[model samples]
Target chain A: MIEVKNLVKTYGDKRAVAGISFKANDGEILGFLGPNGAGKSTTMNILTGYLSSTSGEAYINGHDILEDPIAAKREIGYLPEFPPLYLDMTVKEYLYFVYELRGCRLPRNTHLKEICELVKIDNVYNRRINNLSKGYKQRVGLAQALVGNPNVLILDEPTVGLDPKQIIEIRTLIKKLGKNHTVILSSHILSEVQAVCDRIVVINQGKIVADDTADNLSRELTADHKLIARIDGPKDEVIKLVQTIPGVVSIVADMQRERGVWEYNIEAVEGTDIRRELNRRLMSRNWYILGLRSSELSLEDIFLKLTMGESVNEFLADKADDLEERYKEEE
Target chain B: MNAILKREIRAYFDSLIGYIYITAFFAGSGILFSVSSLQYGSTDMSGMYSGLFYILLVLIPILTMRTLSEEKRQKTDQLLLTAPISLTSLVLGKFVAAMLIYSIGVCMTIVYATVVSFFGAVSWLTVFGNVVGLLLLGAAYIAVGMLISSLTENQVIAAIGGFAAMLVLYLISAIATIIPVDWIARIFTELSFAERYSPFTYGVFDFSNVLFFISATVIFLFLTIRVLERRRWS
Candidate 1:
C-alpha cells in the first residue's frame, strides 16, 4: 500500500501540488486523470524519488520515500514521460545495463529476456532505441522498467501514441500486471481509465479533485437518468401523455414525427426505471409503443461535472463555494 | 562506473570526434617528429618530447571536448544519473577514460626516445622523467577539458571553451615574459605548466612541480563533478 500525507510541491510562489492526502492500496490499478500541468507528473516524480517534494511525505509499502529512498525506489518501477534510454545501446544492452544498475544481483539478463518476450519486443531487442518506431520503443521502455519486477509500477501516459490495436494490447497487459502489482497510470483519456483502472483520481491544476471507483464517481455525479420513448399515436397526444407521467419530467419530439408515430426523450429520477410502467400503461391505452431507451451519465459527463475545469486553486475555490452554499442551505 | 566508462569510450569511437582527435594528435606529433628530429639531424629524444608538449594545447581539447556534452545532448545523462551508482564514481569513470586515452598518445612519444638511443647517448632517467611529466601534464589538460565540457550541452561550446582554457595555459610561459616577474607575476609564472615542465625536460625531477600538475588535475576534476551535480538541482 502507498500512503501520501499532505503531499505538497511548491515552485517559488506557486504550489504545483497542494496539501493533499490519499492512499493507493496494493494490487490496485489507480488512474490519475488531469489536464496538462496538473501536477500528475510532479506527484509521480516525487513518489519515484526523481524529484524531492517541497514538503510532506510519501510512504511506499512501509518505507518512507524520503528517509529510505533506495529501498522505496527498489520497490517501484517508473516510466517517465520521456523514455530514458541510451540511444546508442541496442534494446538488449540497455535492458541488461538497467538490470545491473538496479542491482538485481540475479541473472536479470534472463529476467529481461523474459520481459521482452512478455512485452512482445523480442524481435526488436537488437535494434537501437532511436531507430525503432514509437510503439516499439515504448515497449522497449516498458521492458526496461519491468526488468527488475518491482512491486509498484508507475506509468506516465503509457499509451498516448499507440494505435487502437496496440492500445488494446497494452491495456490488457496493464490489467494483467495489475493483478500482482500496484499500478498507477496517468492519462487524460477518461474512458481508458474507466476501462482498466479499478479506481480513479481526477486532478485539476495540482490538486486532486475527485477520487473514487469508476462506477461510484459516475453514479455520484448523475442528477437524473435520461431515456427516450416512442409511442404510436398522434404526435401531439403522445408528447402530452409522456408529460403527464408523474415520474417523467421533460420530452423532446425527435425524428419520425411526420407520421402518426412520435419519439421523445424522457427524464426520470435516477435509479427509477419507468420503462416497464410506461410500456404497461401504453398497452392498456391501446397505444402501440415503437422504441424506448434511457441514458445514464457517461464518464465524460461525470468528469466534466465533478471537475471544475480550471486550476487546482480555482477548483478548490469552487469547492469552497459548494461548501459555503451547503452551509447556507443548512442554516 | 565501468559500464558508463565503456559506453563513453564507445560513443567517442562511434563519432568523428574520437577519430579526428587520435588522428590529428598522433599525426601532428609524427609530422613534427619526422621534420624536426629526423630531417634536421637532431637526435635529442627530449627535443621531440618537448615538441609534443606544445602540440597538446590544440589536441587535448579535441580529445576531451565531447566527453560530457554529448551525454547531455542525446539525453543519455538521465540513464547515468538514475543508475544506482554515486555521482562521484560516474564522473570519475568518464574522466579516467579520457585520461587513459591521453596516456596512450604520451606513450607514443616513447618511440622518439627509442629512436634516439641508436644515434646519441640518451639518459634513461631524464627520458623517463620527461615521459612522467608529459603524462601528468596531459592529465591536467584533459581534466580542464572535462570541466569545461560539463558546463554546456552544446559540443561546439564545450570544445571552444576547452580550447580557450588550454590556450591560456599554453601561453602561460610567453605571458610570464610580457608581465613583471615581480612577486605577483613570479607567483603566476610559477603556476605556468610549461615553466614547471622545463625541469623535467632538463633531466631534473622536481617533485613539487609534479605535485602541482597532479593538484591541477584533481582540482579540475573536482570542479567537473560539482558542475554536473548542480545540473540535477537546476
Candidate 2:
C-alpha cells in the first residue's frame, strides 16, 4: 500500500505540486490522469524518494519516505518519464547493475532472466541500450524496475512513445503486474487510463479535481438530464420549437450532421426526462427527428469538465457561440 | 556502494576516456622521466616526479569530468538516487572509482623507477615517499574534480570547470606571492597545494603534509555529498 498526505513541492516561486493527497490499496492499479504540466511526475518523484516534498509525508508500506528513505525506497520501483538508462551498457549489463544497485536478495541470474522474459525484451537482451528502439528501451527500463520486485511500482507515462501494438502489449503487461503489485501509472491519454486502471485520479494544476473508479466518476459527473437530438428541419425553427417545450432548460444546435440536419444538445432541469417531450414538439412542427439519444458523459467529457473548470451548460454555451461566429463568417 | 564502484570502473573502460587517461599519464610521465633524468644520467627521480605534477593537473579533469555530470545529463541520476543507497555511499563510490583508475596510472611510475635503478643506485625510500605523496595528492585532485562534476550536467562544462579549479590550486602559491597583504598571502600560501606537495619530491616525509592531503580529500568529498543532498530540495 502507498499513501501520500498533503504533498507539496515548489520550485523557487512556482508551486509545481500543490497540496495533494491520495492512497493506493494493495493489488490496485491506480491511474493518474492529467494534462501535461500537471503534478503527476512530481508526485511520483517524491513518492520514489527522488525529490523531497516541501510540507507533507509519503509512506510506502507504512515507512515514511523522508524519515526512513532507504526502507521506503526499497519498497518502490520507479520508471520516470524518461527512462533512466546507461546508453553505453548492454541490456544484460544494465539490468545486472540495477539488480546490485537495489540490493536484490533473490537469485540474480534467474530473477533477471524472468524479468526480461516478462517484459519481452529477452530477444534484445545482449544489445546495447543505445542500439535498441524506443519501445525496447522503455521495456528495458521497466525490466530494471521489476528486478527487485518491490511491492509498489510507480510508472510515469510508460506508454508515451510506443506504437499502438506496443501500447496494447504494455497495457496488458501493466494489467498483469497489477494483479500482484500496487501500480501507480500516469498518463495524459484518457482512454488508455480508462481501459487499464482500476481507479482514476484526475489532477488539474497541481490539485486533485476528482478521484474514484472510472465508472463512478462518469456516473456522478454526468450532466443533469441531457439529450442529443438530430433534427431534420430549419435550424432557427428547430431551436424555437425546442425552447417552447416544458422542463427544457436550454437548447443549442451544436453541429451540422447531414447538410440541413443538425445535432441539437438539449439540457433539462434536474431529475427531468425531456427526451419524449422534445421528440413530440419537433415532430408536431414537421421537424423530422432523424436520431435521438440520452447524452451520458464519457470519461473524456468528465476529464475535460474537471480539468477545464467548465460546467456542461457553459461548455455547450461556448460551443453555441462559436457556431454562431462561424455562421456569421460564412454569410 | 560496491555496485556503483564496480559499474563506474567498468564504465571508464567501456568508453575511450579510460584508455585516453592512462595513455596520457604514461606518455607524459615517460617523456618527462626520459628528459629530466634519463637524458642527464641523474638518478635523482625527484625532478621527474615534480614535473609530472603539472601533467596531473590536465589529466585529473579528464578522468573525473563524467563521474557525476554524465549521470545527471543522461537522467540516470534518478536511478542512482532512487536506489536504496545513501548519498554518502553514492559520492564515495564515484570518488573511489576515479581514484582507483588514477592509482593505476600513478603505479606505473614504479616501472620507471625500476628502470632507473638498473643503471644507478636508487634510493628506494625517497621513491616510496614520492609514490605515497603522489597518490595522496591525486586523491585530493580527484575529489575536487568530482565535486565540480557534481555541480553541472554538461560534461564539457564539468571538464572545463575541473580544469579551471585545478589551475587555481596549481598556481595558488604564485598567486599568493603577488598579493601585497602579508596576512592574506600567508593564508593563501597555507592553502596552496603546491606548497605542501613540494616537500614530498625532496624526500621530506612530513606527517603534517600527509594530513593536509587526506583532510583535503575528505573535506571535498563531504562537500560533494552536501551538494547532492541539496539538489533534492532544489
By DockQ, who's the top model here?
2
What fraction of the reference structure's interface contacts does model 1 contain?
A: 0.21
Q: Candidate 2 residues A204-280, lDDT tens each?
A: 77999999997786566656577888999999888888888888767777889998999988877758888778777
User: Model 2 off-target regions past 4 Å?
Assistant: A221-304, A307-312
TM-score of each: 0.78, 0.90
**Model 1 segments more than 4 A misplaced:** A1-3, A12-14, A59-69, A221-304, A307-331, B169-187, B197-199
lDDT of 2 by residue, B112-158 (tens): 98998999999999999999999999999999999999999988899
Best by TM-score: 2
Place model 2 in a CAPRI quality band: high
iRMS for all predictions?
Answer: 2.6, 0.5
Fnat for each predicted structure, in order: 0.21, 0.87
Cα misplacement distance, residue A166 of candidate 2 (Å)? 1.7
Q: Is the docking of candidate 1 incorrect, acceptable, medium or high quality?
A: acceptable
- Residue B169 in model 1: lDDT: 81
Please give, for residues B35-148, the per-residue lDDT of candidate 1 as tens digits: 877887676566667777778888888888888887778655655564446668878888878877777777777777688678877678887898899888988998999999
